[model samples]
Target: MNSRITSEIFEATAEPDPEAGLFLNVATNGLAVLDRLGLRERIVDKGHRSPHLIMWSSTGKRLGTVPNGPARDPERGSVVVRRGILHHVLRDAVREAGIPVTFGARLDRIEQADAAVRAFFADGRTADGDLLVGADGVGSPTRRHIDADAPSPAYSGLVGLGGVARVPGLAPTPEAQHMVFGRRSFFGYLVRHDGEVYWFANVTHPAADRDALRAVTAEEWLAVLRELHADDPYPVPEILRHAAGELGGYPIDDLVHVPHWSRGRVVAVGDAVHATSPSAGQGASLALEDAITLARCLRDAPDHATAFAEYQRLRQPRVEAVVGYARAINRQKRVTRSRLGIAIRDAMLPMFLRKAADDTRNDWLYNHEIAWQGSPVGGRR
Candidate 1:
């Protein structure tokens, strides 16, 4: 989900790689979408295993283990790829389709009419369309145009910092992602088979200013990171000490609720409506799925209005569920100091993992298959 820790491809699967570390059970949640764009098989073939998610307490005690996801190939699991590669693949597809992409166009307002929707830009340029698919992202003006009164995204009271480093002490295992609940923060890392480690740390910070946070220097942030994981484990400090360059940090935010996804002829998709937090690791996957479903709805429905309604009806429920799941995971990643709380958390996590072993536990989520025929999964066409 993070754009910063980009690389070729790794395994983000249902098992953990002891030699590599750990990562979320990132499955092929949006393979169908990529397939439509003729990019799924190519991306998967280049991907690798991100096997297991291993949790540890601040003192380095093994808390529990969970498969990256269920119904995955136990021997291999989901393939992983760099975010940039996906972008490049999509860009190539767009180029092949001869779609004109206008960069540096600042959207100002939405002018809607009975037959079409026009997006007014600050540069006096306008793009009129039968339907405006607002994939602009979080802080989307299209979303705002849908409902001016909609509340902004909520802050999670945390700052996220990550970097790609060559940590020789870290064993090479691209298939694994490791998470450590530290004394005052959350730390996670996974190394590719080439010994290049992709690592991140989440610290409790009340500030939300992007400019000020970006101004913080590498040495300063490294010192802060050093203290957060100082007492956690052996290689924690070693990894930080060997970082490649400056640490990039950003305020954590999530769109828990959106007042209106569609108004007149404009409809929002992906992070534009329900922006999932990074904790879920489904941000990109969910967005890809949204694009596919929205396109299908529009194709199946006779008119733009019906298409927008059907799209929202089918998607609103699923995105809400995923957002709730991400919130629950976010709480666990936040800094914790209570002894009883920590003990209860440590105990319940394993139990939850055990229950998650049931094939049906995540069926509503991971089991979603894109149907290209029949009534489909949405409302009446």
Candidate 2:
């Protein structure tokens, strides 16, 4: 089927910023989908191979390691890349496939007919097609169009901040990313072969005070981060001190459940439907899974209604499961001032990690494979 993409961005250029600090950890499952589209090599080439996540405590003690993805093929594990570079690669791939893209076409409303759907943009343009997919994200207008009472994104009680920095003589973290649960916040970093460090911190903040948090200047935020990690470890402080450019900051929000994913010819995908916290590192991978599954359902089902139902049936359970898992991790990252609580968490985390590593608990997540050529799981028409 032919498709068209519309973006609110004023320009069609993919690289919004060459030095954008935002990064994504695309798991093996996500890479599998890219491989199916013949774009895996192109995307992975621009990323660092991150195969394991190593956790540390505020006192600099190792809290065991968890495989970033499945261990079946070590080479095909998770990869860390700047979000802008990933977007550029995918944008190029879409262009190469001859799919037309319209920029600055923000959706103002959607009109649906029995046999077709029409999208009205704020810029006085309209596009008609057999279906309208809402990949617009957490603040999706299409979501409300499908169901007026759709649930709004819930703040994850964490304000995320990060930036790229160069630390002279810093050793590269080969095939791994380091995470530290600090006294006041949670920090993660990965070093590239070129000595450039990609780091991010999740600070515990009240959801009601998001606006106040946003009002803080970048320099002030950096200073707060430095003090948060000052007594934690060596590199955490050093990385924040040398952070380059304007650091990116945003309130991490997620949607665990949405009553309706589709109404008529319009359907939501990715963050528009079910968004997860970055704690589990499954946001991008789950979205890719949705794309592959939805395409197969559309191809195999007899009609659009059947396709949409089957797509939701196949996706909702898995998506909700992952979101819940991420929420659990987010709770662990929440700052605890009580010394007893902190001691309990530090002691229990190692045991939990050991069990998880021994049993391959995340197999259901990273080992998921999309059967593109197979018929839809449910034989409904």
Query: Tens-digit lDDT track for model 2 on 1-381?
Result: 323334222222333565664798988888988998898998788898998888998889889788888754567679999888887887788788766676657788999989988888887878888788888877888899999999998988888889889998789999989999897899999999988899999998877366687688889889889988898977899898898667767888889999899999999889999999888888888898888788777777778788899899988988898899999889999998898888898898888876544456677778788777654342211
Candidate 2 positional error at 200, Å: 0.5
Candidate number of the best TM-score: 2
Candidate 1, 333-363: lDDT as tens digits: 8766777877777677667665443344553
lDDT for residue 61 in candidate 1, whole number 0-100: 74
- Pick the lDDT winner: 2
Residue 297 lDDT, candidate 1, scale 0-100:
78
What lDDT does the true structure give each of the candidates?
A: 0.70, 0.83
User: Residue 147: error of model 1 in Å?
Assistant: 0.7
